[model samples]
Target chain A: MVRNYLYILTGVLFLYACGSCGNKGASGTNGLNDIPDDVVNLGIAEISEEAMQGFVDNMSSPVEMAALIKSLNVGYSNKYLAPTDKIEDYTTNFQQAFSLGVYGLDLGYLNMYNKTNTVLDYISAIKTLADAINVGQFFDFTTLKRLAQNNQNLDSLMYISVHSFNQMDNYLRKTNRSNLSVLIVTGLWLEGNYLATQVYKEAPHPALKERIGEQKIIIEKLMIFLQNFKSDKQFQNLISELSSLQEEYKNVSITIELGEPEAVEKDGMLTFIQHDKSIVNISDETVQRITQKTEDIRNKLIRK
Target chain B: MRPYIKTIFIFALFLALARPAFSQDISELTAQCAASAGDVTYLKDFPAKLDAGTPGGKPPSAKYSMLLSKNTAYRFTICTAPDSEGEAILDLYDMNILIGSTYNKATGKDYPSFDFKCQKTAVYHIFVSFKEGKAGNAVGIMSFVEKL
Candidate 1:
């Protein structure tokens, strides 16, 4: 009897472990198989869907731009942010997802500047948009709101807000809603660029200019991502609009010079100082054109 | 009867020990990693779970590609799951050349985090793997430290 019980128990444990392993394998795939036929049937051969998803997943966070702006001592202005009142205008999933990214960047900016009062507005707007897209569960609004209420918790607020956005992005990709993820990313990128360009127009900081010029790399990447979904009419229009922006970016040249890499260990932490540097040769006229184009694209998208 | 009771107890012990390895929550692990990021502004995270490599073969690693702007200081911090047997090592690479890593091969040391002062505006790769190709779970967090 003892031997029989042991055999049965081992069998149950083995079956349970196997079942868990099977589920992990199923979820590990990019969910390409579960994607709707219309979505994946398009000729997306130039870049594999997984690669595109990875690109989208790894794009820079908006908070980095906001932090840079704050570090530059650029005065905080609510004028550059998308108005919070327009959330209701976004009815389609594309609009909501994209605007969610827009508001998320704005929230990051507010959190960086300790603009506590306006933070809630963007958070609420984000929550509404997140819920619309079925990703609201990631937000933890009550905790976010409480954190936002205290200026002393700026770091915590920033971390939680950005963490929530990352979670939403990850969940979207895992469930095969990468098209929506792309829209959210585009919206965030457009707004961040718009803020930097607008600030550059007024402040004209060298670091800010170099940062704006670096958008050439990002816009090119975004254009490729948008093209992957060009079979959809909405994506087609986005591609056409961003292509003009990409054209302006062509005039901005980035050159890389390789240098010897150096690493240092201090207090048990390793630090790498990259010797290879990139030089951005962007003409002021080109920046002006890029700025005008960014404003145009941003206004058209947000206003509609 | 005594043998049967002992067998049942052993079985329960095995299940208790193995459950955490399989059921560890990635979000919780990621939060722990984020905390290690300190006051730097959080940007994004790369969470990976890799199985051990075959004996005498290449160790498995998870790679993520990111665009790092010119003249910016970014921090990369790593946290491994409590139940994992491996220590996570994160390496930053440009093209095929290694730029930096959390572990110093020459010194045989491991750091929980590292800072990369990126001087280029191009796509770079972040590779995370376990020491000795052991199966493990880890989250690598990229945070903005400053603009250089």
Candidate 2:
């Protein structure tokens, strides 16, 4: 049976790759770049004074910036979002904006670290700066979905997630804890898989999902690190957020079970799509506690 | 140049219709592939030569210098790297001849069957790339065929 299946698959591939199958017409391209700057503003995140001085001192050359972006895995790939123009925008301007955002913070943080020599102090100050900027509310899930659907500025979404991971990596490095730094790096790898899966699940495609799943083991390992290391502040923040999100997920699970929206009231709101429309439902009290935990992390960032 | 453009456009029209219909058996085959994030879209030129027999993930390093012969039917496929698993737009040319093209979202390691016929034998080039980044990813290609 397996041999027969393989033959059938090969035959199908042969027929599909050859001229026997007709063309599937091209999808419409995302129109030209008219995205406004305000849609992607780098908010008021305070960096350490030493970090800022360091950034100014080490003014990155274009070559260096390009290399950094490439190393961070922040380039456009033609295999996912297309017509080529969209990819170009992502690989170009979006990358620039992200570099600007992270560097702006990195410079300040470096300065503070050099001046104070206390990593915890730097983290607190940085959190205070992040809090002032209201960064968390910048791109909600809905905004992200819209960008992915329109194929506009999706790279920004990617940049933010990866950039955040990089920020944590930098923090871990400053603390001189090589072990936690590895965990942070692992999280970065896993986050890519998570983003790909989230994108594929919204729009069902076997090939795309399969492509996303190719990196699943890495992502699962990242999740394991997040679960295991609770002392790391950044990991703690991510875990808290993921836990709250899990509550939202549980509401959906309950809906799937009981056939109707449950009236459970929680502090955090979970929204999922059903039949092409977004359905919002409240979470249970357990979910609320998770939300509180997330809020606490957010508060610490703001206070610091 | 304008007239040459018109001639190329008109020839493209003819190639589009004649190859798929009542065309004679041909020795050459045509194919097209789109760009992948992994496919090096930033490349300004094609590899010197490509041998289909090499293996997967190993593209030809040499640029193609030969064109297709007249009366040859070709097969084309489009795909993207998993990171770029989505829509891919393809346009084909044979030494400035607008041969044919197609698109596909069925992401895999291979392209879809959107084949065409070649009416001339010369050193032809195929250009494949995408405009989007981190999402609409694809790669496509065309290959020759023979009867033995």
Best by DockQ: 1
**Model 1: how far is B31 from its true place, Å?**
1.2
Q: i-RMS values of the candidates, in order?
A: 4.9, 28.8
What DockQ, between 0 and 1, does each candidate earn?
0.43, 0.02
Candidate 2 deviant stretches above 4 angstroms? A1-225, A228-280, A283-291, A301-303, B1-148
Could you tell me the TM-score of candidate 1?
0.85
lDDT measured at residue A30 in model 2 versus the true structure, 0 to 100? 16
Docking quality category of candidate 1 according to DockQ thresholds: acceptable
Question: In candidate 1 chain A, what residue range of length 10 has the lowest lDDT sum?
Answer: A22-31
Candidate 2 CAPRI classification by DockQ? incorrect
Q: Could you tell me the lDDT of residue A126 within candidate 1?
A: 96
DockQ of 2: 0.02
lDDT of 1 at B92: 88
Q: What clash count does candidate 2 reach?
A: 69
What range of 10 consecutive residues in model 1 chain B has the weakest lDDT sum? B15-24
lDDT of 2 by residue, A1-304 (tens): 5555555545544443342123211111111123332321211122232432121111111112222223334433322211111212322222223222332333222221222222223233223322222222222334434444455543333333233333333333343232333332332222232333333434444433333322222223334534544554444666675555344334332111212211111232111111111122333343334334434433332211
